[model samples]
Target chain A: MNNPLLSIQSQYWAVRDYLSPEFVAAGDFLTFKFPVWQWEKGDPSRARDFLPHDKQYLITRNVPCLRRATAVNYTDADEDAEKLLSFLDEAEEVAGPDGKPRGDDDWVATHIGRGQLPYLRITPLPTQPLANLNIKDTADEQIDEIPDMDEIPDMDDEAVGLEEEDDAVRIVHPSAAEVNSTAGQNLLQVRTYDCLISYDKHYQTPRFWLYGYDEPLADSAEQNPLTPAQVFQDVPADYAFKTMTMEAFPHSGQQLASVHPCKHASVMKKFIDRMEAAQPTEGEAAPLTSGSKKGKWGIGGMVRKVTGGSAPPADKKEKEPSGDGEGSSGVQVDFYLVIFLKFIASIVPTIEVDSTTATAL
Target chain B: MAPLQFQPLSSQPTPSFWSALNSLKLDKLKLDDSEQPMEAWLEESREIHDREKGGTIGVSGSVGLGSGAFGQESGERPPAGSVELKGVFKNYNTIEEFKATETKKEIFNSVADSILASFETNAPQLDTFLLVTFADLKKYIYHYWFAFPAVVSKPAWEIEEGGLVAAEDQLVAEARKLADDLSNRSGALLVRGPAGQRTAAPVKDATAFFEGVPSSERIVAFHDPSHLPDAPGWPVRNVLFYLASKHGLSDVTILCLRSGSSSRIGRVSLPGPLSAEKPTFVGWERNKIGKLGSRVADLGPMMDPARLADQAV
Candidate 1:
């Protein structure tokens, strides 16, 4: 709803708007900084919101996934109950270090998770704007002009302000040794998700299909999309330790086989259940800080890992499965894997459970 | 347009749990085995089925039963007066049916009429009916199931490995508490019969099962239609009579979620007992069915295609 360069109102009742304005196409390379401060210093407070906030601007700028973004507001909630963002602007006011109203510079450096990083240099430079290409009227005007610092307020709530500029357009800081060192190399491990956006002619609705890959497929390979098998091939070889591979049972043309690691739902369920079992009647919080399992995969740990955008440490990797190792043909299939497989099957109806390689976990 | 108040961009990546998992290195990540509990539940269900029947009831019929078994086999069985469970309607190769110059619509219409007739004769009060399909109907059914508190058929796959039993078990426990608290007016409890039970036997037959239950109650029984034949013993019709003659309750409504005429995945058939072609059943209308479940909505977002294509930076 923020961008007014173009507006897309959905005729299909199923989908009213985009999930995030930042929907990108398959091959679009997005580079966001993963701060080494949390890893090196192990600062618990700094652990939260480690990922840069400016990544959204770099990703949402006229990518193929969102060519002409929808013009939505809180009032749009009347049409569909989901567009309630207008009323839910729950922003907490954070005072500056000086205990007074903060300026854009102080707010960006202190409040927003990134400590010393500038907003402009968050992601790699954008060569071109691809979002509003279809809007001929707006295409004539340059929309990326940096607003004056005084024109914007230093509030923590809004996505953009006058002080800082587009993340991709800004230059890297001279003093940031880590970023400067990795100038030529890929600092962030980029994962390109091949998204197929199409309108279901029969249902008169839009469909958003996503296939994750370690590498992007070539444009010529559009006809032959990467199968789950092909995608899993690119997954880190070490991941095979926790990977559960699925295949189509019966030979069907429209078949998909995926290799998804343990689902968070499954892990969280066990954690809660264990907690409840230990204290049958007590309404106390689960003691998640003690055990190795609880420390790594507990609800709090997972929230930190997910929200902080950090990976599990290599030294304390999850205990390997008790089965015949990663290459075992008759591997036990867990409930989460089945749900994941079912989701794959739902996408490709002909897909069947590869019973030969899977069993009850 | 509303006054656009874009926040200053920060240097953080979008927060996604699965994406984080996907990005994390494979080394230290632990994969908890969540399927063990559900597998145990399946084994437990099989055990209960075995114990209740006193033996492997209708072991021969479990694989398949011929046309004669519907009538003749029931009479020849032991003096226990057992009937065929008659809950599941196995999948038949609909190629012949489709190629016979006969419209499936017409066949479905006839079947619908027959089901409605059975309902009228037995339990006319069961007016509200819902027929949902399995397999390809997942997206469609899930969209609506979020809104309505209707009986959902727990497929064998879901029960065995998808942690559905735990959810249903919780539902049963909650229902039991409510039933005890308000003794007279409690909702029905959905119970599983057996995965492949073809005979009523003495144990879980419709009559005996209902006679034991308190008044004003119903139990939802689900079966995989892949193993069933497209014949007289349709799953929906059988449940209608089973609940009606056994309990003689006013709420005779039946909702059936089954596979298609053929075992091939995309095809789905919602065999209705009273009325199959309700406004809610046939179409894949998103406005009507967009009330997604909490878990499902949390699964991911469904963005509009135009919005995805929007080029605005």
Candidate 2:
């Protein structure tokens, strides 16, 4: 654990070949390449100021993708290859105009290969095999269980049994860096446990390559499997590439059908039908409520009245008592007889009738 | 009757008058062949002068009479009484001393307020007033003094020292050396006479000439309501009023230039002719336009009728 910072610095040096001089100069001014999170904290207002205001720090992981050997070779052999070569050569010529070439220049030459040399190959570690190697197998008998744990079954034995049940399962742990200063003069400490078995150089490029892996001997050369010419040589052009032309899918025609069949059409249709049935018939009106007229009252007026907390004034109430005979219980009464008796008493032309009525009573 | 003592025997008796006597004398000497020569008459006049010791009057009296007669001979009338009095007394007395008075700080503040009020009352609101002050009448005099010659004559610096001459005799002699130097240095000489002449008119009163120049170029006055009077060396109040009257600038702002400092602090809005309201005053301490949290004094229309009516009683 060389402070981990040194390792990070070395990683920066490794990728320095890819960066421009201006970028390197900028990096020299900055302590490190700012992470995206840190970059986002930059305030535009203080941009005019010399110092950056944001103090928060962030770390970012760097993962390099390897260029295929065939692509590199093709690019070199092609007519346009001279352009790329010239650019690289010009970059090299300008690298150390007055002094010896820096380490980055050497690294660039090695990665891209100098003159007629082959390009570097990179392969990532076989994660599955490495993880499997970490699992202990107690069934081998050479593995012994802990003497104090009679109640507890051997964990190694259980892990081996579980591995048998699902070969994909594995336990993983961090590995130490594989420093090989004697073999290579380079200061970088390569991780040997994570190294891949793939060849470092091939006549044709690999399907996928990771940076920094095993080198193959010159005598063990084999036919490249990942070349496009080799992979598609037997198939017809249309089938091999799957042509997607405008003529095949014209604008006037319906949109191209999905390659995967739609399984839920019937369910969708049922739902649509149910929704259509639930829709109201024409001319049917919606029911009105007190809330519907709330807008007319307005928030201010409503708040005033509600907060006042008093029954509405009698005059303010619009409901009036009805004069019709209908009441709490509807009862038909002799309105004509009552009116006639009142008339007989008020005007004595009705007095004779009133006297006769009294005698009859 | 007196003439009878000398020679009374003529039958006409000299007609009892000089004409008769002169006729008798003419008869006595009668034998005319030619007119009398003017020389004899002149001799006789000389004889009379000699006898009278400078004619009937003394030499001084005769000289005085002669000068008086010459004076009376000219038809030009004397100046009217009031005009003469004005020229001889009033104008001569006070023209040099006439100058604008120094307004009190409080009066300036009030003026600023009034100008602001006027701006609020009027339309087409004015925003700012730029006041340029001269130290005193001297500076104002200098500007006009320099400007007049620059306008009227060929630049004095353009003319050679001896080659250039002024039109007026007074200036010619009085500023002879100055004119020469001015001419050599390409200075302007305010020559008079006709457009192209050797003679130049006498220089009029410089102050009056300055006062007569259009006020626009000489002074720019603006009334800003928001200007503070107490601000050092800041003539916010006076400037506001001057601009209001001079430029008819309403709602003009007054900026205070601090003493020993070029920075502006207080702003006064001068009211227009139509405005009678007070100008809004804001100090530099209240707001900084360039810096954060600086307050700005906003003096817009003060009494907007519509806004006033819109307010609930």
Candidate 3:
């Protein structure tokens, strides 16, 4: 073999470790598992530097769930939803002259550690978008974290968001201000999921697991760990039915509900092509220039409000990769997990687990 | 001022702890429902650094137990850099046994007896938890509950909330070292200080430690896992009981030494107390859903033979 060195690891395996200042402000943190099945100590085939080099899995714990996936109005994504506009206006007025949002105390309280009881938040999981909304069944709606509304290249990209309109949970993460104020803390309860990403030796792709907890019933105050069926309520219908399976976590051996990675490579490839295509065009990198100064949460709401429907939503166009995708201009292998999470966010719509801003490296 | 109430500290059982229980079941104690000694720990307060960068905040500590908890005789105190948590884990032979409230109450009474005995012997301790569990070997799901008992003061303890504040780096460092120190962990513990100068010594030795120390410096420091801005964690309540009843102190200062994040310190008043015979107490951990009942971890979906067979392909 050309390389027997354990230090010579996959470029993508190393990138998963570089997640930035994770949730110290957000009350969440990463849990890392070291590789277990390593070459024996005296084995001659063992790589020189160390035996088990790469991390086996990465877990971001207590990802607070403030709302349920079903609460997101998919119709809002296709329409000029006026309800959210006034809230956006409040954010804009309070935003600094340069568009950077000032740290408003109430805003922080509502978003940070505002874990409302996720069980109470759940409505029955909608398997398909309500046909009455008139949203196109074939529309490849973009995820909600996009930076600019105008950035969506009309239609027909090679890579569509994993969230196909009919089969997916919509991506519009309503700002805390968008929720009815009367619901208040009385309605909000804390339900959390532990999001785990592990490399699959069988599939050679990263596997995802979401372990969820639900509120105790009113009659008895005992713990009710989320059932597999209930956990899927947060998952988009397309992948929920087909890809998710209950499996043993390799590192902890805790039998947990998991998202199988069999189709991850195909979805990730489309993601790469689109991300690369979106990278080259500074075409009116106009909105984000002023928008980024507004901080992470404000980036989308501000852009959507500013665009107000004259422009298309923030979807990416996936032109066929110009063959040179493997070159220096290709997506950094380090950023593989970030994009994986971004796409995964579409699949599990209510989780506040991913920390990536739109300019994802 | 508000009645001093402690936010119940959650039991954070590490994967290894659960796995350790699994090994105990599979190898040695398959059907044995006897109690076994276990060692759990609370972390010493860390310096203020991570929170400013990551903006994360919450309860900073839990009764953290790992693999080494079982199968060995443990000392009364945890080693340095850790706070004392001497616990006992009882594995029931069946889920029915695990759910028996009468049996649970008897076990709880034993824990309370030990707490009272420890206090009576002039070595008061509140770092005790009772874990009643049932591990499903075939399915790999575990059902468990934790109870941390604390004696209630007769008239109730009043608290003045000390909102979140940046801990003095040097003072917290010295106090953290003492809280984690083996020699200082036993008996009642307190950190006496005069601004920059502070030291951790047994509460019994509070009189000696404060020879040159000011009255404002008599601070009882405990490893607190509470995330709330005002209320301290459960373990501190009995300490307050000891301080108010035994030591004859009315107003007390407490340092809720939270690890890995900010620590809260506040002044509390022991309003009225004096019933030594059989003190009243309250403790029973609520399930994750905030209810006082049993919680389930269903592993059939993952570990069932049929599912395993399906995934093998």
Instruction: Report the alpha-carbon TM-score of model 3 versus the true structure.
Output: 0.59
In candidate 2, how many Å is residue A263 off?
Answer: 36
DockQ ranking of the models: 3, 1, 2
User: Candidate 2, which CAPRI tier?
Assistant: incorrect
lDDT value, residue A104 of candidate 1: 18
Docking class of 1: incorrect
**Candidate 3 RMSD computed on C-alpha atoms after optimal superposition onto the true structure:** 16.2
Best by TM-score: 3
Q: Judged by DockQ, which candidate is best?
A: 3
Residue-pair clash count for candidate 1: 41
In candidate 1, position B300 carries an lDDT of: 17
What tier of docking accuracy does candidate 3 attain?
incorrect
lDDT of 3 by residue, B128-229 (tens): 888888777765567777777777666667666544345665666677666556364442368775655656777655546656555456788776656555
Candidate 1 chain A weakest lDDT stretch, 10 residues: A60-69
- Local error of candidate 1 at residue A111 (angstroms): 13
Ranking by lDDT: 3, 1, 2
The digit string of per-residue lDDT tens for model 1 on A1-361 reads: 2222112222111132222221221011111111100111111222213222221111110001100001111112132212111111110111111222222111111111213234344322222322223243233212311332232222232112111222221111122344235323422112233222222223222222334322111212211123333333332222211232322211111112233412333432332334223231111233332332222222212222212212233222242221122111111111122222222222221111111011000
What TM value does chain B of candidate 3 have? 0.82
Question: Candidate 2: what lDDT?
Answer: 0.19
Q: Mind listing the fnat for each candidate?
A: 0.00, 0.00, 0.13
lDDT (10s digit) by residue, model 1, range B1-313: 1111111100111112122222121222223211110000000011001111121111000111111222321111110101122211111122232122123233333334544354445332111221111111111111111111111111100111111112233333333333333332111223323323212121124455545444323334232221111111122333433253343432321212121111111111222232223311111101111111111111111111222223112
Candidates 1 and 2 compared by lDDT, better number: 1
